[model samples]
Target: MDFNRKEMDLLAIKIRKNILRTIASKGTGHVGGSLSIADTLAVLYGCVMNVDPADPGKKDRDLLVISKGHSGPAMYAALAARGYFDEGILDTLNKNNTILPSHTDRLKTPGVDMTTGSLGQGASLAAGAAFADQLNGSSNYTYLILGDGELEEGQVWEAALFTAHRRLTNLITFVDANGKQLDGPTDQVCSLGSIEKKFEAFGFHVISVENGNDTRQIYDAVMEARAEKELPSVIVLHTVKGAGVRKYAEMENCHSTTVNREELEAFYQELDAQADDGGKGTGKEA
Candidate 1:
């Protein structure tokens, strides 16, 4: 399918808006990470991935496993925008009996392929899925998204080793290197010292996007990853925590915070400004 850069960029803005709306319904959420990955999700769900919203369980359809399950709000927004479910259900986020939980759950969410929350576990699960697909001679790809802090998990490296050893080219992984995690800056907590080099050392093709919050860059990187025929690929996204919202991006702790309707409106204002400027609406001022 041909990718429309403009359409994906607009979709990213819409996804960010809905993400804030979803989290605001719950009063608090992992807004930082959720906001950061909006562009990538937009590029993937907008046109890249081969998915059927009407048939969520379609056989051999491309699957996305968000290892940083806390960012489920963004995924939910993307899914809703892609027509997996009614956008009205986004207001039910984290509520009692709501399908949109705080984390991604395969059984609960229509488009979520794997239930992920326990940090590094998603790496193994996605790798296993790719391995199975490879064995079955399936061309469908399995995409994985992991938080930068989650990379500290030993199991992530273990899964990386396995993926590289097995030459799981069908597996494409992304690290949301937003530089901030739960407590504070990821580097301050535990420096990952060059995520690209680490992935290269692990025998995986690594692509680093300087402005990962740009849908165009994310889409280009994904295209590059898809063209690699030998080794597994990982794209390290250099993003700002709480991207696309100046107020939240400036906050000392946007990882998880309270967001009222007023604050949500302020975020929308910033996005609106970006939209008016004919940009991707990530609120990264030039």
Candidate 2:
């Protein structure tokens, strides 16, 4: 797959649109965090990961585990963009018998590799998969994405230690440091001091992406992290809660909010206008 930055940008835009669609379908969902990770997910399912929508169960395929599984709408949007499933299914997000659940469930979704939503346990589960793959002599890499708020869980550090002790080089973790969580800002809730230093202390080669919302930077970060041989790698992405959209990003509680039908229609119009202006319809102004 020849990765073009412009195409990735378009995909990220589409994924963000899908996030809004999912939110509207359910009347409410994790809009902020979902939008925050759109660019990163676009890079992964679009170009970075070695995955096949056709052979989703292939043995050597790379795996993605969204640790902050509440952002499943973003992942679903990416998967749909990558041809994992029909894009039409995106509207069923969180609905009855909907495959697109609020959180990631591997068993229900076609391309989801891990069922997550228990906050901090996803990293450990991903590490365990990496360890088992190493034992089996498989070279597939397991990627895990977590929200900054999730760092408050003790299990994350425990998993980090385990990954380091075992030297799980095939495991790469990305922390979406969006700064805000469900309740409030991370600082007002529980300030995770020096996230990079803490991960480094846990034996991860920490790489910081100043702009986590940039597809090019996220792609580069993943490529750079893939080269680490001695220990696990973690990329901390400094991102806005509602990244692409200016209105949501500016909102204090965009973490999870309601978007009525009228607001949703306005958003699509906003996206189209941005696209016409040669920008990714992020609802942001210059």
Candidate 3:
């Protein structure tokens, strides 16, 4: 339950690196969005979220539901880093008959609480889990992450409204507002005007983090959300579509980029150089 911001930053870097390597192993995956939420995932699974890797099924433990499940590579790296499963499993991502798949599958992945891939269903599922926990008098929170573009789905709003109406304070959602989406920038694709105002209008206690890639900022936002008592809280994370790695971040459209052998080698080489440069930064890519 205790976290050092510096340590969390390093963990996020490691997770992001693993995500790149994993997706590279398969020659393709959701590289952009996966990188976008790396810091947030590290803050959750590494800094916060009370759950035992050894006792993943324990009733009183906190749960995480990834609504934008295409970003599973990030979550998978986080889970493996936290010892939910062997780290080697990450290299097998999306391989035929492998536990790791294109999208998150609870039945398949060791630490995945809910299977999600249809874009907007995970929010509703997390809401249902939160409501059930509340009814059962459990002191656990159900955390959900959704992409900014995913918010275009009407189902997410319905779940948000329900969470607010029921006063499901135990449910906290993080919108990964990384600007761009599959087609292009979310504005050009399907403009979601003022994500913060929209969540606030849905009766959520909203907090806006200027830099979602900052572990300290992410952790602070979660703590603030945890302190809210009246309604569900939503933290709007302003992030780069492809975070951590500079080349990917600079891409205009990196929803899912193909990584050939040379690209992957160059990517890891940059990370190696950063490490050689002391890897001293706390936030943002080195």
Candidate 4:
């Protein structure tokens, strides 16, 4: 399951393209958050996670609970790409009868480990799951990804305390510190000053990766977190809202949008160009 930079880059490109296609089919969805987590999800699903598409509910399988559940499009894309379901299902996202809603639902989705969308509850659930695994003497690890905005909820801190107090070393949390929330920038909305320091104060080990789009750094950070036996780990990842697509990445209103046919065509064209750009399409812009 080891992934080189090239393979990781390709996975990111595929995930980004899948997201764009899904949004196009849905006509409206959460593009910004989904794109922001593409690289991190790529490294996890494409390489690190010990998940089996055939036995998604296996007792010893690694778990990935997307705390920022609005980013379900990305998770769905990654899971489908990883063979948990038919990739064609992505086009049905957000439809009335589609299992792929804007938020994840474990009951309906094959690869989803938790049904999360109520803000801060997902992190708490992830912690509980991790603690359960530890108590049962299972070697499985649980990974949680939280939005910076979601951290404003009081329950996130409560979960942090619980995870640290229990010393759930099998759990790893990643804060998508993309700065922007739904309405505005996180700093302006409610300053979560020094996120890493706050985690350290909660009796957990914390690491800050300046570039969230760097697959290698994310991989190393997660590996380091896994090696820690005494405490839970949090990695504060700096990211852009709409990451890979250039125009969307710069646009303020890219969080959720109506995807017209023309825009969808253009976006897919851009993604194809990115995939064909040799080493330049690796999600890093100069």
Task: Write model 1 residue lDDT over 1-286, tens digit each, in one string.
Answer: 6788778767888998999999999899989999889988998998889899999999969999999999999999999999999999999999999999999999999999999999999999999999999999999999999999999999999999999999999999999998888989988999999999999999999999998887778888999999999899999999888888877777888999877977877877777667555444444422
TM-scores across all candidates? 0.96, 0.94, 0.94, 0.95
The parts of candidate 1 lying over 4 Å away from their true place are 276-286
* Deviation from native of the Cα of residue 42 in model 2, angstroms: 0.2
Worst 10 residues of 2 by lDDT: 277-286
> Cα RMSD to native, each candidate?
1.5, 2.1, 2.4, 1.9
lDDT string, candidate 2, 203-229, tens digits = 889999988888778888888898888
Give the number of the best model, judged by lDDT: 1
> How well is each residue in 215-266 modelled by candidate 3, as lDDT tens digits?
8788999999999998789999998877767777888888998766567667
Alpha carbon lDDT at 3, candidate 2: 71
Pairs clashing in candidate 4? none
Evaluated against the true structure, the overall lDDT of model 3 is: 0.86
Candidate 3 vs candidate 4: the lDDT winner is 4
Query: Which tens-of-lDDT digit does each residue in 200-253 have in candidate 4?
Result: 999989989988877888899998998998889999998888888876687886
What is the lDDT, from 0 to 100, of the residue 105 in candidate 4? 96
Give the Å shift of residue 56 in candidate 3: 2.0
Model 4 ranges with Cα > 4 A deviation: 273-286
Clashes of 1: 1
Candidate 4 structure lDDT: 0.87
Q: Give candidate 1's error at residue 76 in angstroms.
A: 0.5
Give stretches of model 3 more than 4 Å off.
261-266, 272-286
